[model samples]
Target chain A: AQSVTQLDSQVPVFEEAPVELRCNYSSSVSVYLFWYVQYPNQGLQLLLKYLSGSTLVKGINGFEAEFNKSQTSFHLRKPSVHISDTAEYFCAVIPVYNTDKLIFGTGTRLQVFP
Target chain B: DTAVSQTPKYLVTQMGNDKSIKCEQNLGHDTMYWYKQDSKKFLKIMFSYNNKELIINETVPNRFSPKSPDKAHLNLHINSLELGDSAVYFCASSQVVTGDNYGYTFGSGTRLTVV
Candidate 1:
């Protein structure tokens, strides 16, 4: 089985400031990493993913994440956050083989203030 | 057009009542999934279907049943709803591709509140 842990429960940052959301995963085998964002009363939307290529993966809304194999971490980062970026973020992982079901973290709320 | 759509975005019902949440995906994906998000904002996969075949069924209670009539539709039917079952249920679908990567497209989610 695969599991994910989001270190931070909430991260507050001023608008235009950089932000980082930490995520860690534990799996018996190799896995795929993903980040998702959800606004209030909305379902999760895919942000970025790290599969096999470069360690640095970029996604929509100017968000990016780095996959670190040794540390079993995939942290999401944004150079400058906008007020609209405030949302709940989730880090997920799926085993290399087996089913495509994703194991999500507890989620971290990113609050971008003006 | 919405990639993944769910009907009755909000469902409020009483205990012991049965309700069904409908989900549809038009992305031509071969896999569909049902997930539950608790009040604490923890997302967990409940069931997954591929090509209308049940593939992954989590340790969800028997009262929670998932039915996939076709490749594009997956519905969740809950019997004897309980207070703990009240949460946001999301429907997602993904296409099986290489790179060990598959992007999931999620529905707007149905918020179920059992009184």
Candidate 2:
């Protein structure tokens, strides 16, 4: 079974500081990667997704993630973040061939302190 | 306008009671799914329906039943709810045309609290 691992449970950062949320998946088959953000008491919103494209994928709200095939990592990055960026971020993956189901990692709470 | 919406944004019921969380989608998507988010915020897929057909049913308990009246609606009915069933349930929908950039549009979750 394909699984996603998000090592960090919580990450605290100051506003305007850069941040990186690491995500790794256990799948040798081709897969589609995605990042979703959830505000307090809100639904999950898509931040970005990596289909079959370049390694670096830019998402909304000045967030970007790089898909490293060799390392099996798709780490999300933001050069500078705002207090509004504070939310629970989830990393998800679905195998290319079997795209019916999405496996999500335990979310990482991004606490952007002002 | 909301793409996906679940009713009873907050539901509080006693144990052994039966409750249902209604979900509907206006996105004209072909696939809809139910996901459960635990207290620790770990999400796991419970059920998925595609074009009104059952596709993915995880290792969820038999007490939980999912009904799809159409491709646009997927409602979850829980019987004999237990304290462990207290969690946020999310409803999502996707078009799944080619599945290249597959992503779901989720509804504002229904927070269920079983007392």
Candidate 3:
């Protein structure tokens, strides 16, 4: 079985400040990692994904994440953020060889202010 | 255009009433999924269909049934809805890219409220 844990339930950052949302996973097999962002009253949008190669993946809206296999973690980071960046972010995992079902984390609420 | 779309953006109904939410994906993807976001903002997979065949069915009760008539459409029907059933339901689609599974395109979501 695969599970995703996003440690930060809420992260408050001032505008133009850097932020990082931590996500860790536990799986017995190889898995695919992804970060999804959901704006207020909107569905989730795919931020980025790590399938194979390139530990670092850049996503939309100037967000990036590094996949650390040894840490069993994929943490999303941004050098700077705007007020519009406030949203709920989810970390998901899918087994590489088994079903393509996505197991999502509880979510991290990113609150950016000026 | 919206790639994955769901009908009834907001549904407010009484308990014991059965309602259905429809979902459609224009993208030529082989997989479709239904996810529920609870009040705590936890997204959990309820069901998944691939090419009109059921593939993943979580521990959801039988009252919550999913119908996939074809590869592009997946509908969820909730019978005897309870207050706990009040949540945001999302529809998503995904496909293979370069021999690996890619991320999903999600619908705006349907907010169901049972009073």
Candidate 4:
């Protein structure tokens, strides 16, 4: 079985400050990783995905993540964040065997203050 | 147009009552799924349908049934709802290609409250 763990339950940062949301996954074989963001009372939106190729992948809203196979982690980072960036971020994984089942981790609440 | 949409954005009902939540996807995706988000915002997949055929059914209670009339729609019917059933349910769709599948497009979600 595959699972995702997000160490931080909540992260507080001031506007224009940098932030990193850590995510770790457990899988024996290769897996696909994804990051999703959900605003208040809204569905989740895909932030970025790591399927193949380079270790670092970039996505919308100026967010990027690096897939570290040795550490079995995919951490999301932003050089600077805005007030509108406040939302719940989730890290999900799909084991190569069962691509249909997406296992999501407990979300991390990103609270941006002014 | 919304890629995925779920009806009854909010549903509040009493325990032991039965209710259904409907989902439709405008995207021509062949697969649809239902996910439950608990009060703590943890998400878990409940059911999945591909081309109106049941494919993946997690270890969910039998009281929670899913129906897919067509490839574009998947509905969930809950029986004898309990307070634990009170959570946000999300509908999502995706197109599966040969080897790898794309990411899912999620609906706004239905907030079900059982009192």
Best prediction by lDDT: 4
C-alpha lDDT (0 to 100) for residue A112 of candidate 4 = 99
- Candidate 2 residues A1-114, lDDT tens each? 799999999999999999999999999789889999999999899999999868999999999999999899999999999999999999999887877798999999999998
* Residue A97 Cα positional deviation in candidate 1, in Å, after optimal superposition: 1.1
Per-residue CA lDDT of model 4 for B5-68, tens digit only, reads 9999999999999999999999999999999999999999999999999999999999999999
Q: Give one digit per residue, the lDDT tens place, for model 3 in B1-115.
A: 8899999999999999999999999998999999999999999999999999999999999999999999999999999999999999999998865454567889999999999
Per candidate, the number of residue pairs that clash is 0, 0, 0, 0
DockQ of each: 0.72, 0.77, 0.74, 0.70
Candidate 2: segments with Cα more than 4 A from true spot: B99-101
| Model 1, span B1-115: residue lDDT tens | 9999998899999999999999999999999999999899989899999999999899999999999999999999999999999999999999886555577889999999999
Order of quality (DockQ): 2, 3, 1, 4
> How high is the lDDT of residue B64 in model 3?
95
Lowest-sum lDDT 10-residue window in model 2 chain B: B95-104
Q: What TM-score does chain B get in every candidate?
A: 0.96, 0.96, 0.96, 0.95
TM-score of each: 0.97, 0.97, 0.97, 0.97
Interface RMSD of every candidate?
Answer: 1.8, 1.4, 1.8, 1.7
Q: By the DockQ metric, which is better: model 1 or model 4? A: 1
lDDT scores in order: 0.93, 0.94, 0.93, 0.94
Of 1 and 2, the candidate ahead on TM-score is 2
- Screening candidate 1 with a backbone cut-off below 3 angstroms (N, C-alpha, C), the clashing residue pairs are none
Among these predictions, the greatest DockQ belongs to 2
